[model samples]
Target chain A: MIRARRYQDARAQARSNPELAWWVFMRVSGVVLIFLVLGHIYMTFLLTSELQASYSVVVNQLAQPVWKIYDWLMLTLAMLHGVNGARYSIDDYVQKVSRRVWTKTLVYGLAALIYVLGTMGLFIISKAMLAG
Target chain B: MYRAREGQWAFALHRISGLLILLYLLIHVVSISLVLFGANAFTVLHDIYGFWLFRVGLIAVTGGVLYHGFNGLRVAIMDFTGWGTAVQRQLWYGVLAISLIGLLITAWVVVPRILAGH
Candidate 1:
């Protein structure tokens, strides 16, 4: 029996270069973020009659795994994707190739640090809730 | 060198908006999660929706989500395909309309719920 082999090259290309996918995704995601961010801000800053949302409120909501994961996904995607975008900007305007590279390196490092700290903070808080 | 103006803008905004949105999402989740963790920590969000300022904020958040999320989708497509440039111009308008509609719908749902004070 003769077997047909899949076009592994194209698939690999697509996987390696997700540019096309991300392009289409930007429109959809951007539109969605507009709503998500606006809703989020309003709820946090404007809606609460109380000037501050108590810590208890925060912990209670974080307990839901869905929300936790939602946050994690959002955080990771935005940080990585956004910084990646910034790297492009640096490349476009910044004349020096080395500068662009260095800037991106720093930007990426900062993003990583923030992600680490933020995740750790959440984990500690989460564990505290469970321990009690 | 390829002019990455649009692409770069998309990239920068993706990060800015992504970061902004992430903070909000985190807080949002945690706000609600606190209730699950401790009985004493249970904070009812019922009051939040009712506040006028929060209502407006919700509308803006809805706007941000639509803009940032949808725009992110647009850039994502552009990276891997050549068709990205062609669609960007038209899609911006399309995105705007969709966002408006979404905001309206959200308002419709949220207003009654909040105003009724349920």
Candidate 2:
């Protein structure tokens, strides 16, 4: 069958793995982050600053437990997103098996560590703020 | 089974992390909206955020924010830039190294300050 022949070709000649997935994602997400990040910057950096932003102001804003949960989650997501995004781009550029493994291992491991710490920190702070 | 290498791992992780960020951003927006909407909500956030546990969380979250935000810029550049082509391979590692170093430095100062405050 033509399909079978094409499949064989992919298996025999496609190096180690099909990278079409990551390639596709970087594109789709690159477009999204442009808006998410830009709006984020504009809102927090630009607008927040002019409107009497301060520690107290932040505290005032964070008054809701929902916001605390929101921040904790955002912290986790942002770390994972950025790290992964970088990895996607990096993999396309770097092909050395040894280096890539160690590098990605390090990136992911560190990111995981950061997420744990951040979650705990946020939880502790929120509890304190709520209870205090 | 063919073992996937480091590059592959990084690639997989990147996509997973991206999805995570989308969720996190959603939560953040909803939470902040509480404060924007009224004084009562703002008071609750202010009190909870000041707690020792919350302060620690703030530091960790800040680290994530810096890393994600900065590293994103790195990715965008590597994908789009001429320099990325010339130094292409080295760029990602270079960005990763700088990010780690930058995070460490920022944490050193910020973490200690938070600790001192507590």
Quote the TM-score that chain A achieves in each candidate: 0.66, 0.55
Q: What does candidate 1's lDDT look like per residue over B22-110, in tens digits?
A: 55554554454444445454445634545777766766666667767676556444444577657875666666677678778767766
- The C-alpha local distance difference test score for the whole of candidate 2 amounts to 0.51
Best DockQ goes to which candidate?
1
- Kindly list the interface RMSD, in angstroms, of each predicted candidate in the order they appear: 9.2, 11.2
lDDT of 1 at B69: 64
Best candidate per lDDT, number? 1
Model 2 off-target regions past 4 Å? A1-132, B1-6, B66-78, B81-88
The digit string of per-residue lDDT tens for model 2 on A1-132 reads 011112333245444454433343444455555445545544553343312334345554455577567666456545544665657555766689898888789767766765665465444443234334
**Which runs in model 1 stand beyond 4 Å of their true positions?**
A1-52, A127-132, B1-62, B74-90, B101-118
Candidate 2 chain A weakest lDDT stretch, 10 residues: A1-10
Model 1 earns a TM-score of 0.51
lDDT of 2 by residue, B1-118 (tens): 9998544444454444454554455444444445333447645665565566755554444344444444455555545455543553465466457557755765565565556653
How high is each candidate's TM-score? 0.51, 0.44
